[model samples]
Target: MTSAAVNRRQAMGAGLGALAAALAGCSGESGPVRRLRLATGPEGGPYNAFGQALAQAVAASGRRIEIVPVSTAASVNNLRKLDDGSVELALAMADAAGDAVLGRESFPRPAAVTALARVYVNYTHLLVPAAGPVRSVKDLAGRPVAAGAAGSGVQVVAERVLRAAGLSDTSATAPAPPPASAPATERAPDPSADERPLGLAASVSALREGSVDALFWSGGVPTPALSELAGEMPLRFLPLDDYVGALRERYAPVYTAVTLPAGVYGLTEPVGTIGVGNYLLARADVPQGVVRELLQVVFERWRDLLREVTAGARLEPRFAISTGEVPLHPGAVSYYRSVYG
Candidate 1:
């Protein structure tokens, strides 16, 4: 049979199976299965993969789940959406979670959310073209740079780093005063005139085109897009070891020193960096039974889930209680105690 015929047959078979399941439910008082909505990140992002794995595990338990794809903004957005009943679950960074619960930075109001588990550490990578003259963060002082997308965790962290270095986005864009009130023709353009803060894809494109000297991104090691970019243009991941202590002191306790291995992205040597853990968050008001069943499925089918997605490999049970600022949800607490205690 042609490929189209095979696809049509498969579709009909799935429809028949769904009809049978619906009829079976009508025959009993067990009621229809509850459906959960999960919010993930953009296409080809870690959150998207994690959501898919969780949805698959929930499906295996005879529950219905719909995973929604969202943009890669800061975790605060995810927490807010969950609190407002827009989404049942979300993935968030630990630092972002801390800020949200405390009503600081991007979160205008306090977010009442609880954690299911800690997923993975996200490294803040400062990358530059290998052929570029920029070697250190200091070298990027007057150079064109992509500070990452607006409202993204990467942009938040980038702003913090720039402030630590005594640079402000406002100052970077301000025009220098003319000497001694000289004529406008004698005035020079601002050194930072060409600088721009852009999205991840734009940053990569700028670097590839030799238009930007550096870019900062907070993500997991071996990001597929970064790997592909490295293959075409020589790239170097900068080490942030020198400022690790200062970052930890200024930020919450979520910051930690981490080492990225050599072979993960075809680098010749390990890269030392600073990172924070990412967590799964749910509103405090979510149904206890629903949260309990979700966590149960996570721990029980962890290996199978890991096999299905890259992000699942970071779902370690030991990290469930490792959140720094946000309080654990009562539902998550119950599940953790039953499994770990």
Candidate 2:
């Protein structure tokens, strides 16, 4: 063929190839896959176990979900991460969610997070070595205690209880006398010595070593570590019944009268305490479809989930909407109302 004919044929072939490529792009069958990220609490914690169960359910939905383990300061940090988009989902204390949304306590600004469900109730647990003298909140006034790690929901509640009990870090060890030359105005007001702040692990160690008098934990009933500790060491569960009225008056409405049943960990009697629910939270900006699917998976596979953790058995459909102050996510609301209503 002539040169001109050959050039014309090459140009036509190139145009056909470009047309094919465009058609392939518009096929729509080869779409990108979506992934859901769930942020769980520190290793071996209830939040972590719950998160793993949730991730499993989501994965079983024929969708992709990844459970990410996070060493958090508990509810506060979890809410912050969810708001900032660092995590799409997280577990938080219902009270903490309320506080964060209202910008109360440690929250400097309101967090843009929404609740999916109230998963389970967390009990305020005060554990002392079985052989120790610490028997109640009043008994701990001048004693060393573990108030939970900083940034944890446990720490916040523990501190609130201490303040309610008229105790402080310095309440147990203040010097007996002020300087002779100091002005009267400079005199300390009830200078009680400060108690050292111990983290969760450190508190456990302290108890084992007999260095600390007691440890305070705010978590779901039958916490694994607490159960394990009870088996290994003689431990006592302090009752919060005496201060229930005061605790309710001072804090959010999360605190409720409850009992730790006898034989939960071979206890001789049920421990009376105030309780709060644990909530599943998500960023306000998460795609509505994703949240809806996540909640759907949780409810649809409820039985399987119940087997994953002890707390799972408590996630009833009616209780899913049990959150008080934190507004339920619209997506979750749709799912809950469909099932419960």
Candidate 3:
């Protein structure tokens, strides 16, 4: 062929290749982006960190799959987002997820979802001033307390605990957190400026200034905010073991017994508390292959996930069957059986 013709042909080929590459950006007809949108907890929360970690690991593998993490209110909120088709992977508390699956209280109808993995236990912490007179859950009947913000997992669980303690219609929910738990990246609105989400800082501040007698928080042992609370002031964690039976009887079997060791938060004594299982959740309709691959990224590279959020290390193969309330995603079950068996 003539030299000029050959050059022209090569130029055409290059242009066609570029066009094809641009088209490949989307799956076509399915969605705009290929990356799965995962709803995690609010900024700085463990769920947010865990979701980002999983995304980072999967992207590093050079796989076609990509994960985009969206910060959410965690647990119950995550489930709601998942149900609305706004997100795919979500981190939720077993209790909340169970309610949705069973089509019971709080959820008028069943939400279509399958359990991913029971990630870890969220240890409930009821913080009271060491110098204060309140020593137990029942002690603060009419006293003001810092329950969590609206629509948050904290708020839901706190309400349940309060009811279990027969302290319903009492205690006040903190409007906003103190400065400590507030994110530096985003300044919280002034309590007088506008309604704001209640957080650890608000609760801690309320507890410190004697506005609230106690606060209810749940997270891994040595919850960062509570840890800081201990350093700044003498704090005591109220034992919830006494109410565990009542909580389980009234709620579900997701509640288990756990004890926080001494020195975790500078406490000289261990405190018994009811532990709730935290699970990774996915919509029931997610492609089985995609779910299977994501599970691989989470479990196969377990150490990397753990590094991102230490609580994730607990997402082991043996505990695959721990989720009894919400049914397991077939993809996850298949993956676990192949490995565990």
Candidate 4:
């Protein structure tokens, strides 16, 4: 058969599986349709955008599962919802996921969650005014900075980056005073950055209004809100790749060096920055059959889904299985075995 014929055959098989699942769901208790809540990020953010698209795609694919995208504060909040059994699927930064699994950082205890796939890479973006006094990460000391929203993966990484840059007090969630043993000269500058917990849009507004000296954001290249802000004002991106080694050494080894290519947001040269993987996660108890069917839609219809996500994201099955440290859901392992074998 031709390639097109094979494609049609595969699509038909998937549709049949969905139909069977739907019929099975119907046979039991004339119950409501099987809906799974997906915890996404703040409105207009990458997580929410992609989650909405994925939910729509699943609906269009005639799957028995209805993915409802729930707007949230992003990674950390999403993970808590999963811990409490409020959501089945969530999008999270790899660093946050690793921390949750190991009971590190914000998580007081290890969380029971499993990965479905490593969906994409989020570039750490540190936006500053072009003519501002803050030229580098170290220059952020004693300045007002709009860190990411409280309980967001962006905040999680932002705090680490600040600590690596020796601005320990810039952390909004957990701020600690400089050690008393340290000499005055060796301590951080007199006053530390005033860290505010602001979401993407609010951060952009704060930056534009001169209320904050810099803002930290983690998202796909050319995050829509930031892009719009760039058009309205002259902006400079501070490099974060310099601290990747420190972040990896102190925290989990989830940070990688990545570049935002030139011409994006009117840049004249590529900017090296820190990168973190984003994962599609589920609670440990999600049904195996449900996960299997969901993975079918995610993999087979990934091209359509990609158009809805960040530009540089990779959704291929080969890359999807690289959820380091966080164990893969049994259904995800089964799906990959079927594809690879």
Candidate 5:
């Protein structure tokens, strides 16, 4: 062949290859690698641990997709990240997710997000010093407490729990001492509860230092940090079942009465508290195939996830599809249907 003809043929081949690459990128096809950002909770939290485990297992599966876990304040913050396009996926409490869909609480407007699965249940933990005078939610008046981190689902629930108990945010109102074990009817809008927004580690530290009398956290049973803290000092978990009724009556029915069985944190008997489902969320605009594939890996490699999350029960289709109020992504719907069939 003539030298000029040879050069022209090579140029045409290169142009075709470039076009194919562009198409693959747009379609998220097998020709290119796909990296997705997953917004998780702060370090040492269940969401963060689950995200890391998920990323590792998915990588070992040799799939074309790569999950990158980003740590934040959890739930509400994670949802905001997903809504703003900073992250493609998020781990959120169902109560916060429902509030996001309704454009309330931490969310300023309706978030464009959908659930991939209801991953697990978060047990509301209200930790108080064993020797402290705060025996019930009513005793929290005028006492400083760590009410989860700012912009977190834990914080959202903490606020609701306080409201349900007829207490007001300490940040908004002056602290005043109330009688111990005051009735809810008498506690209406009591501004004496001193609530401080702090994360797991900080809250544990504050509690240990006697800076805070109580701490509220929501996570999987036996959160590693809290478990370790329990070993160092005798702590007590305040029962919250009473507040769940008012929580459901005033807000969405996302709160449930659940038992924190004995042996966790060395309790002699079961502690009744609120339960909220944790959900894996994604932007509503995410491709259906991507969500489906992600769910496939999650269900198949669930054992690996369990090692990190300790979600009490096996990750199953029936339980996963129970994400109330927050609609499932179409891809998740398709995946669930396939399993049932």
Candidate 6:
């Protein structure tokens, strides 16, 4: 079959899966459910872990819907998938989502994405081995680093952090063979593949093997993988607190200063860093009812999710409007209004 025919079949298959899952969740309730596809991050990343937990909670919300979380590179890549109709919902960084809607940066043209909720703040981390000499972002100038996988929001954050610090990635990278990501979903290629840096896991491994100086991570804190790695070995965070203004100027106004409390990773003092909100995004044309239901998953099943994932529990209706320049989905607005008013 041709690519077009294949895509049509995929859509039909996705629709069928969505229907089946929704019906399974309903048990004996008589309600019509719309299935949605959620574009999450790489397999082990916070987005993926938290997204999976959130998906389960939604499936059990006693609502008329089902969500399929597809592992992706996050943010920009998710937005691109939204444009192509490959996914109906996506976990995107506020900055990348804003840039896509404006047809700037990674996006080639204007995108019609809207926000379901400003979920949580993604705290950018520049982690280096405690014994390693590199202690700041500026010290990474001539060192090997893992900027994040291709097309990942982690890469987007890494690039901006580097540019603000007046450093450039001159590390030479060899092509990495693609591995199966989350069953059968083909991960979109990273745009900055030519200027290679290792991905998160690879960077952590490299740090242990003494190949790379540091790795950049932008996700909710108490990230399980990083926590486990830090527990195994001492790690230090290079502060990005000073460059918040430069990052905001270069990206969007959504950037803010945040402090990673000391001891979350066993450090003695708090670490300062820049943060960006990660939004639950959807195409502007997705049904308002679906968006409202997605938001409902966040509000209704929040406590259960909190037990499942710390980041997943951080969803608050008050902070739901924090997604910087990205406009809210009408369905979300309706849901929020019903609650707050």
Off by over 4 Å in 2: 1-31, 64-67, 169-199, 303-312
lDDT of 4: 0.88
Pairs clashing within candidate 1: none
Pick out the ten consecutive residues of candidate 4 with the lowest summed lDDT.
168-177
- Candidate 5 TM-score versus the reference: 0.86
Q: Is candidate 4 or candidate 5 better by lDDT?
A: 4
Pairwise TM-score winner, candidates 5 and 6: 5
Q: List the residue pairs that clash in candidate 4.
A: none
| Residue 314 alpha-carbon offset, candidate 4, angstroms | 2.6
Q: What is the lDDT of residue 11 in candidate 1?
A: 100
lDDT of 2 by residue, 19-136 (tens): 9988888665444445656666666676777777776777667754444556566787888888788887788887788888998877988988888888777788888887877777
Candidate 5 error regions (>4 Å): 1-29, 170-191
Worst 10 residues of 3 by lDDT: 188-197
Tell me the whole-model lDDT of each prediction, alpha carbons only. Answer: 0.73, 0.75, 0.77, 0.88, 0.87, 0.78
lDDT of 4 by residue, 73-167 (tens): 99999998998899999999999999889988789999999999998899999989998888998888778899999999999888788877767
Model 6 Cα lDDT, one tens digit per residue, 203-226: 778777877778888877777678
Measured on C-alpha atoms, candidate 5 has an lDDT of: 0.87
Better of 3 and 5 by lDDT: 5
Q: What TM-score do all the candidates reach, one by one?
A: 0.80, 0.82, 0.81, 0.86, 0.86, 0.80
TM-score of model 2 (CA atoms): 0.82
Give the per-residue lDDT digits (tens) of candidate 5, residues 51-145.
99999988988877899999999998898899999999999999999988888867788988899998888899999999889899889976898
Candidate number with the higher TM-score (2 or 5): 5
Name the lDDT of candidate 1.
0.73
Candidate 3: tens digits of C-alpha lDDT, residues 1-341? 99999999999999999898777755563444356888888787777877888889999876668899998778777888888899978888788888888877667888888888887778888888989898887787667778776656776677778777656643244344457866777774322211223666788888888778888877776677778888999888888888889878877788888888887889788999988888888887887777877887877776766554443336567675699689999888877877777
